[model samples]
Target: MRVRQMAAPLGAIVEDLDVRAVDASTAKELNRLFCQHHVLVFPKQQLTPDEQIAFAEHWGELIPFPYGSLPGYPNIIELRNRGKARDVNQHWHSDMTYDPTPPKLTMLYALEAPAIGGETAFANQILAYQELSAGMKKLVGSLVATHSAKDLARLYGQDPDQASEAEHPVVRTHDESGEKALYVCRAFTRQFQDWSRQESKALLDYLYEHCVRPEYQARHQWQAGDLVMWDNRCLLHYAVHDHGEDPRLIHRLQVQGTSPV
Candidate 1:
């Protein structure tokens, strides 16, 4: 299999690799590329729900998204266009960060994509942390932030009072690559631990903006046969909702991860 870099900071387009038939050695090599590049896009592939789940298990244990899952496939969920007002993922975030151990990685297999828009954008948090000033790095290294799923819970018709919430370090060490990454995101992270929202707003907003600078970002335009997987541990992603009423259907899976250090 050949892998080509897709962007400056984080993505790789993998060619000559079929997800439905990855051998042991190829799986190992794919894991290495995943750690190094943080995102992999496989084009012109077809995988059923079962096939996708089997492929995802090569990395680690599969995790069921708390919100919802596809019928007859507990580990896979469907992502489709609701409406512009109901777009829950328009902001940048790591998936399910409010869980004690968020997903290590997420995979999406597109079955339908709009003609004009509906691209997913990613930011390299590892690069974002690396480019911070020394003093800023030191400051963030000592901080922890609270992440909440209240908005998601409400949107999914669940009780907001029981939504998941957890605290994680502002800067977390990637378990596989051992690189530091800025972990705060605009969607879920509420405030630094022990700091009120009023007090944390300034610094948190600054960090939220800093983590997604264009120099550290890449965009992927979706296609019907594209399978895109990304490391949630070291990156933040935004789902662009510019497709309006156009149909976009994707099946998603996630692998369970260790708690961020």
Candidate 2:
């Protein structure tokens, strides 16, 4: 398989490879590419839930998707929508951060896609941290941010307090590469762990804005039979919600991860 960088921030597209039958050496190289590139896009491919799970296992242990899954497979989350105004994926964030151990990687396989605008965007958080002023970096290194499903529930008109919450380092280190990345996001991250909400607002907001700089992003427009996945450890993604009444179906799965240090 040949790997090519997508654009400015960080992403790679792997061409001329069949996803279903990756060999041991190929799997090792793909995993290495995943760490180096962050997002790996394998276009023009078809896969069943079983096939997707089989391919995913080569990278890491599969984790349960909290909401629900495809009928037979407990490891896969089915994303089928005609579009809605109050979309959960509208904001930029990592997945399931409220959990003590959030997902290490997330994969999405497109079965049906919109013809127009329903692009998923990703940001390189490592770049975000590296570009910050030295003082800002030092301050963030000393802090931990609150990430909660409660904040997400509020956005979807649900009982906010009933949702889960956890605290993770504002700057997390990559397990494989030993690189630091800004971890706070607008969707799940609430505020600094020990500070009052009011006191944490300004700083968190600045980080929320800073982390999504255009230079650190890459947009993927979907197509049927496209498989895309990202490293949740060092990147954040936003699912765009502009495609109205268009049928979009994507199968999702994530791998278990340790708590960010």
Candidate 3:
């Protein structure tokens, strides 16, 4: 397997790696590489649902989708568009932050690549946090933010006020690398733990913008047989939906993770 950093801000691509039957030593190296580079892209890894699940298990137990899941694979979800619905994944955010434990990492296997534009962008939150002003860092270091599933529920056609929520520190330390990262996202994060929405809006909006600066981001265009994975602990992703009327399908899996520290 060959690995090299991508042109973007914080991801690397690994070529000639087979995901179907990854060996122990190869898996160990992948883990270390994942810690070093928050996102890893493996082109031409066309894994089936079962094969994808097997590969995902090498890291940890998979996180099941609460609302719906794949027919036979409950832990893996399908993201397919035959051309109708508006793009729901346009924001720069972390996945499932409303859950207490959220997810350790997420992997996406591109099955049907788009003809034009279905590129996904990633932002390095560790770098975002490190670049913050000293006063801002000190201010957020001791604060916690509330993430709600209801905001996401509305987008998926569920009840808007479902009210499932979790509180996590604004500045969270990575479990694997021990680095601090900004964890608040514009999608699910509503307000700081003890602050009202009106009081927290300005700062939260500022952080949401700061975390996704172009300098800290990398973009990946879809490929028919690509497998992309990223650490949810230190990266925020933006899924662009500019490919109208084009078919796009990807199978995604998430691994269960610990609560933020």
Candidate 4:
């Protein structure tokens, strides 16, 4: 298969590969490519729900979306933002970190996109982790942080205190590559468990600020038929809400994963 870099830093487009019939070897190679590239974009590709699930299975088992089931397929998650509806992924996050096994890889197939701006931004958490000061790394490495949907719930007008939260390693080793990554994000990471409220806020604010440095990021401008797959273990993503009157619709399939090993 032919691969072309989208830009200098992060994304790549794989050409001449059939999405429907990816073989085991190809899938393994793709997984390696995904780790190296962080984001893989397939342009002008169309997939049925079954096809999407099947394609996702080439990498690993399909994990259902966090909120609920899709309209037609009870397993798939509809990632759509209607003009009247509230956008779900407005902040930077890794999917479903509150769960025991968060999604390893997330695959999003775009059905619709605005003519103008609705680009997705990805930050390389591995790079973010690697670049931390020696003292900062040691400080964070010694602590475990709580990741929750509570803050996001509050932002969406839901009760923040009622949402689920979990303590995870601040610097987690990726199961596949054994590379360390900063596993914190603004949306889900509530606090460092060992710290007091004031201390937690201060440390978390510092981490969130460091995790999003421009040098570690790449922005993806969606095409209507683009299928984007990303390694959730090593990346944090943000969806830009630039679409005004028009709607943006995406269907996402996540791969089942274990806790960071």
Candidate 5:
């Protein structure tokens, strides 16, 4: 497998690695690479739903999206917002934090794209955690936080009545490498547990700001057949909406994982 760095800190374009069909050995190596790199981008991989799901299964169990399936295929999550709808991932977030066991890995396959923009940006949460002071790390290590869709909906100008929250460790250790990451994001992380409302807000806001520093991020521009897989546990991502008239469509598959911590 050939891996090319897209940006200095986070992104990589993995070429020559065949995702269409893989041997057991290659699949194991790919999983290891994914853990180290955080984000792996396939420049031009055209895969059907079955192919995508099959490839995802090589690493872990597939997690069905909460909102049902794609239009034609009810199994895949349609990550498109064209014409009237437009792309909705304008902010940084880890997917499905509302669930007790949020998806550990999220794979997105590009179907269509515009000439410019719609690039996805990823931040290295592990790096974010590593950059903290020893004192701050000790303080955060003893804490836990609540992640909720209700908090996210409110940020998106939607009501929070339908959303639910899950408690996750403030500092999560990666299943494979045992690397600790700051398990927080702007989307679902409401506040630190054991802190008052005011204290929670201040602490969460500080952590969120620190995790998204520019030096720890990489942005990937899309190609029609590109397939990207990211570790949702140790990274945060944002989809940019730079395309105006043009449209972009993608299919997403998620991998099941234990709750944070």
Candidate 6:
């Protein structure tokens, strides 16, 4: 397999490989590329739900999404447009951060996509953390943030009051690579631990905007045969919903991860 850089900050496109048949050596190389690049796109591939699960298993155990999953596949989440106004994925985030042990990686295989305009964008938080001013880095290093599932809970018709919440360090170190990354995001992170939202808003908003700056981001235009996966341990992603009412279907799965340090 050959790997080509997708963007300067992060992402790589793997060529000359078939997802349905990854061998042990290829799996080992893929894992190294994944930890180094944070995102990988495998184009022109057909993967059934079972095949996708098999590919994901090379990395770690699968985690069932909180809301629900595909009828027969308990670990695969089916993604589609829910209208622009109510789209839960439009905002930037790492998957399921409100859980004490959020997923370490998320994979998506497009079964159907619009002829135009359904894209996903990713931000490299490792680069975001590296570019912060020394003082800012020192401050964030000493901080912890609280993440909540209230917005998603409400969107799914569940009681927001019953949503799960968890606290994670503002700067998390990757368990495998030992690299530091900014871990807070606009979607779930409510406030710095021990600080009121009112007091934390300015700084939090600054970081929310800072982490996704164009220089640190890459975008992927979806196609029916694309299999894309990203490391949730060091990145934030946004699903663009500009395809109007056109159909877009994707099967998604997550790899279990440890609590962020």
lDDT of each: 0.92, 0.89, 0.88, 0.82, 0.83, 0.93
Q: Write the per-residue lDDT of candidate 1 for residues 2-102, one digit (tens) a residue.
A: 78999998899998878989978888989999999999999988899998888888999999999889999989999988455744699999999999999
Per-model TM-score on C-alpha atoms: 0.98, 0.96, 0.96, 0.93, 0.92, 0.97
* Candidate 1 local Cα displacement, residue 102, angstroms: 0.2
lDDT of 5 by residue, 4-106 (tens): 7777776667898668878788888888778888898887787988899888888788878755587765558886656533323566888887789999999
Across residues 141-190, which tens digit of lDDT does each residue of candidate 4 receive? 88888888765676557777677778888899988788899998777787
The TM-score, computed over Cα atoms with residue i paired to residue i, of candidate 5 is: 0.92
- Model 5 residue-pair collision total: 0
Misplaced by over 4 Å in model 2 are: 153-159
The residue-level lDDT of candidate 4 at 107 comes to 89
User: How big is the positional error of residue 200 in model 2, measured in Å on the Cα after superposition?
Assistant: 0.7
Q: List the residue pairs that clash in candidate 5.
A: none
- The lowest-lDDT stretch of 10 consecutive residues in candidate 1 is 80-89
lDDT for each residue of candidate 6 in 98-159, tens digit (9 for 90 to 100): 99999999999999989898899999999999999999999999999999999999998999
Worst 10 residues of 4 by lDDT: 79-88
Q: Give lDDT for model 3.
A: 0.88
For model 6, how big is the CA root-mean-square deviation? 1.0
Best by lDDT: 6
Output candidate 3 Cα RMSD. Answer: 1.2
Candidate 1 lands at a TM-score of: 0.98
